[model samples]
Structure formats: structure tokens, C-alpha cells
Target: MAFSPLLDELVESLRCLPGVGQKTAQRMAFHLLERGRSGGTRLSQALSNAMDGVRRCDNCQNFADSEICGICVKPERRNGTLCVVESPSDLLAIEQAGDYRGGYFVLMGHLSPIDGIGPEEIGIERLLSRVKSEGVSELILATNPTVEGEATAHYIADRLADREILITRLAHGIPVGGELGYVDGFTLTHAFRGRKPLTD
Candidate 1:
């Protein structure tokens, strides 16, 4: 027998998540109904609250509940060095790495002409203004190593070429434990392009 309208709607809604197919959504709907109705209700409320409360930070463009994110407000963070990333998730990853204590400016997205995303949409002007006004002297580009990422990095570099600020990109290569045989052609090319000389 077919599910009721509510159950069918639940399954269909669940399929909106990435990688969630019809069967998986149906299973999720059944699990939520049978074993975790209260948890499901709590999840729904939490989602609603988060959707309503979350806002992009004014300083760094990261997701936060307030005008600025915690990292941007922290006095301990390096202010003169700004790390530019493609998304808040990338900023989180860098934070998780526990090495970068500098400030961040999230592009939120790359410049994709075909996709209709442009420089203004990604807040490039805001970032440039911040660099000019906030005593920022360096920009570390932490964009992903992809075609769009490269284009975005290049665009920013060209724009800031006349400025006195220094600009650098994240190193792209195979992981520490990854072998050359397993590394792909694009990664190998990057590794070669960014090769460093060994200390004698």
C-alpha cells in the first residue's frame, strides 16, 4: 500500500538532501516515524530555529548568529594577514587544521560566468575594501585546486597586483601519505609546478 500524504511528503522532502535518493528518503521517513518521532520533532524545530537565526557575518562573511563571527571578533587572531577561502566550510577546515590563526574573508562562492555567479556575488569588493581599510598586508588564497578556484584566484591576484599587499596561494600536491602512483595527473602537475628544492 502507498504511504499517506504526510508520509509521502516527508519522504519527498527528505530527498532534498544531497545524495539522498528516493529509497533512502523513504527509509529515513520510516525510521523517523517508527523509532524517533520525538527526535524528529526536535530536529525539525532546531532546523527551523537555525534557518531563522543564522546570518552571514558582516566582517568575514562566515555564517554566524551575530553581526560578526567569533573568529573575526577575537583579538588574538592575526589582523594583518587575511586568508581568503571559497566558503565557510573551507574556513572551518582551516580552523580545524589548528595552524592558521589569521583572519579570514570567505568568498562564499567562486566566479562562475556560466553559472551566473560573479565577483560582486562573491563579495570581492567587500574583501578588497577590508584589505584597504583594516591594515591588512597579506592575502593567503585558500581556494580549492580546481578550474573555477584557479580562475577566482587569478582574478583576485590581478585586481590586487597594483596594491602594496602581498598575495599567496595554498600549496597543491599529493597528501603526506599518498603515493605518487595513486596521485592523479592534475595533482602531479601541480606538485611539479610548485616543486621546492631540498635542503642540502
Candidate 2:
């Protein structure tokens, strides 16, 4: 049986979400129409507000509502030690682990020359400027254990070769092909503590 035009539209729209297939989208549409009209309205409003207000941090490139992020403004964070992450989700996962007190620099994405993403695309120059002017003495590469992540780390390390600072990579407890957002807090904590220095 075919759905009404509006119902079909809703189902198709819901499929935009990841992992949401036809059946799931149909079910979601029904639920929103039947028992979640108010909730659906609120969710749409929230999505709109976030799209309008959210932007990247000028300093670290992390998602922020204001020009500077809270982490950058907080004075208690360790300014000399910087943790670099691929995305804000990775940064969130590390923060949830709760032992890291150093500042962070989010890449938002890694180096993918095939896909045309280069150093300027991910704002590596902005990061280097921060290191030179912000007194960052140590940088921790907390990118995922993927090929792109490894390449990005090496590229950043090479760029900073002229700068006088120590560099480290997260420990190996994290399995290959793993993303920081999917790792549990305990594993992330262990990895953070056992981080190894990258001299080359």
C-alpha cells in the first residue's frame, strides 16, 4: 500500500539520517505523526537553531557557538601541552575520559590528497601559527588509527620540524581502524596515559 504524499515525503526526509533505511524511516515517520508531534517539532527547531548558531572555533577549529571555544578561554588548561584530534567527536570522547587537562587542536578532518583535502583545507597553517604564538611546547596526536590519520600526523610533524616542540602519538591500546568516538572511556584513558613520543 502506498502512503499519502505528505507521509511519503516525511519518510524520504527521515532517510537522510545515517543507518536509517526505508522501514526505519517509515516507522520513524509514523511515530512522529502518531505519538511524537511535539517532540518532532522541538527536534526540527533544535536542528535549525544549531545550524544557525554553530561555527568553528577561530583558534582550534572545534565547533563553537562563539568565536572562541570554552576550552580555549578556560585559563586552567595546560597551554604548553596540546592534544590534536581529527574531529570534534574525537575531542568529545577524550574529554569524556576525563583525565586529560591539556588544551586541544581539532583538525576537523585528516589529509586525503586523493579526495583533494590538503594542509590548507584542514587549517594546518592556523594550527602552526597557534603553536608558534601560543607557547605550545608539546603536541599529542590523538587522531584515529586509520591510514589517513597516520598520514595527517606525519604531515603535521614534518611541518613542525622547524619548531622547537616535543611530539607524541596516542598509545596502541586502540585497535587499527578504530575511531576515538567509538572507543570507551576506560580504553581512551589508558591510551592517553600510555602515549608514546614520535621523534621521527
Best prediction by lDDT = 1
Tens-place lDDT digits, model 2, residues 85-140: 99999999999999999899999999999999999999899989888888998999
Off by over 4 Å in 2: 1-3, 174-200
Candidate that would win on TM-score:
1
Error of 2 at 111 (Å): 0.6
lDDT of 2 at 42: 98
C-alpha lDDT of residue 177 in model 2:
92
lDDT tens string, model 1, 48-99?
Answer: 9999999999998999999988988898675699999999889988999898
